[model samples]
Target: MSQHSSVAGASRPVKEAGFFTKIKNVACLKSSSSSDKGKGGKGKSKSLSNKVSHGFHLVEGQSGHKMEDYHVAEYRKRKNHTLGLFAIFDGHLGDRVPTYLKDNLFNNILEEPNFWKDPEAAIRSAYSSTDKFILDNSMQLGPGGSTAVTAIVIDGKDLWVANIGDSRAVVCERGSANQITVDHEPHAERRRIEKQGGFVTTLPGDVPRVNGQLAVARAFGDQSLKAHLSSEPDVRHVPIDSTIDFVILASDGLWKVSC
Candidate 1:
């Protein structure tokens, strides 16, 4: 099994060469209130009611390149309190964008001055700002793009999830699953794309792609397609009370097969 690293408080960029290439890895984080089960999960108890214990798993796709999916788990100790974070990034073309996100997305989000007072707005601003950074620093990121789904847990009870592109976050309550983020596929968002003067096309044997390039309507990077694509994420708040169980965050590789 590959070992996951901690980027909790480091102020630096993640080296691309250190990107994970394993199919399964395990890491125990000293954080609070969040758990996730990806597709193909086994041995997980169904009755986790109100308790959060997380485990993540990933496998490379048949696509002829390094796995483009990346996940984040970190704990930060502040002067007054501690923060727990979890996230998933699914990249297309190259893993640089996802790698960058794994290292910095939440740090950017939490650094927002209004995060404690207005988390939703803070998340939105952070996402857009992060996307801009990716674009401005494209020389290091390359021409690829990525999707993101992130979760923030406060006091192990209040939960917030944010996403761009098709990667997803789902909550399980008493064995029933409920999606917490929206998938931004080109097909479902055709109208929005057309409104922006962009087109979605389904070429022979391929799903719809924005300008026939990206399958997702929203993403970070893809500098050439930025005007047609969006980086704004859909953010939602869910209270981890008695009725809720755990959450699932996965890339399209798992979601497409599971569904």
Candidate 2:
């Protein structure tokens, strides 16, 4: 249980989006035990009691977009107590912004004193605070922007998930897949963007995009669009009792090919 420290904001150079153009295949690692069932199954239990195993892999496509820009962190404080997170961070101009977020965002969320008791509020607070921190420190990070989608697994039974931008997470249950993240396309997020004084555009055969520069209406970094592009993440809670088998968290490139 580490606390998050606020960092000073600064401006830096931006990276190119070419690194994210590659396609990749990812597989979920099977766990040895079912999180839904307990030692004796003696009725409902509370306080994060369960066991689960998780795994994932990534491969880059020929588009020169290396798969390294994405960031993932898994921390288990103790046996059966864990946190798993995934973020796609599509960089329009450079990778510094996404890389910085990958390194700091989750730590900031977990370090909040309220997270243990109220995961949702803590997640929301962290999302906004982190975004502000990024904007405040834009000068240090340089130019560029990144989208984030993160899932926190606690006690193997309770899951707190959040996302800002187009990155996504999906749950697999009973041999079927259900999308848990909402794609914040310009069309879908039009009203929100308009309220924030932003605009959207669409090309033939393509979904609406924000200002024709990005598909997601919100994301981290992109200081130039901060007024319209938000870093607020949509948060959800999933219980272990539900028919949950596994989950997949991916970037746009993977989604482009798979979906």
Candidate 3:
């Protein structure tokens, strides 16, 4: 089955969220009990439980900085357990913030003693703590921020998705698409920003922005705007069984072009 979901452009009236919470949920693209024919050959059959493929590209924006990274890995926690992790980070103003998250965010969540018990709460806490870490290390990370979307697959059966900022995640089941995350746009977040003692503004031909600088209302880093912005992520869990076929995670660039 094939499914497609278009992420909205920045102009869309969607709430913005980021810090891209990384949580644990497991999903498999194919049923483990079935021997499916490989797409690459007529007779080959591959184990769907462990089959994964990924690729990425880098292109410098007009500002001359190239800062986007995606990650997919099987993370081992205990002697007998492992989790599939996927994430995408879109950097603005600098790359340090996203790079730092790509390296540390998941590790922090995995370290939580109760991660497996209450994954939702664990993810929320991890996102907040991760943002605090960014704020505390502003001196080294610089005054920048990133949008993120992450997925954690546990036991290859449950899929947990989370995000902050405009990045997104989608799941395809029975040839239909379902969005699994909410986009945090400035317009939708204005009230929250104001209540937090920060403000949002919309200039000519520009989408609403927090403090008239950053485009996303939620993100990791951006120390200058951290007080008004949020790093909390919207998270969801879906069981990867016979019905669900695949998942998609991408940055605003792809969303803008197609969503």
Write down the lDDT of every candidate, Cα atoms only. 0.69, 0.59, 0.63
Report the C-alpha lDDT of model 2 over 1-259, residue by residue, as the tens digit.
0011101000011221222211111133222211211111111111222344344334445554433244453444643355545444545566677777767888888888888889999999988888888788889876667777788877666777788776777765554557787877678878988898888888898667777666778788878877778777889887855467555566665566642
Error of 3 at 49 (Å): 4.5
TM-scores of all predicted structures: 0.79, 0.75, 0.76
Query: Please, what are the lDDT tens digits per residue for candidate 1 over residues 1-259?
Result: 0111111111111111221211112222233222222322211111123234454555554545666667765555554645557787888777789889888899899899999999999999999999999999999999898888898877666788999988788776554668889999899989989998899999898789999888899999999998889998999998767666556676776567532
In angstroms, give how far residue 127 of model 3 lies from its true place.
Answer: 1.1
Task: Kindly indicate the candidate among 1 and 2 with the higher lDDT.
Answer: 1
> Which 10-residue window of candidate 2 scores lowest in summed lDDT?
1-10
Question: Considering only N, C-alpha and C atoms within 3 Å, which residue pairs clash in candidate 1?
Answer: none
**Ranked by TM-score, top first:** 1, 3, 2
Model 1 TM-score on a 0 to 1 scale: 0.79
Error of 2 at 164 (Å): 1.1
What is the per-residue lDDT of model 3 for residues 52-104, given as tens digits with 9 covering 90 to 100? 32222222333333434433333444535557666767777766887888788
Candidate number that wins on lDDT, 1 or 3: 1
Q: What is the lDDT of residue 206 in candidate 1?
A: 76
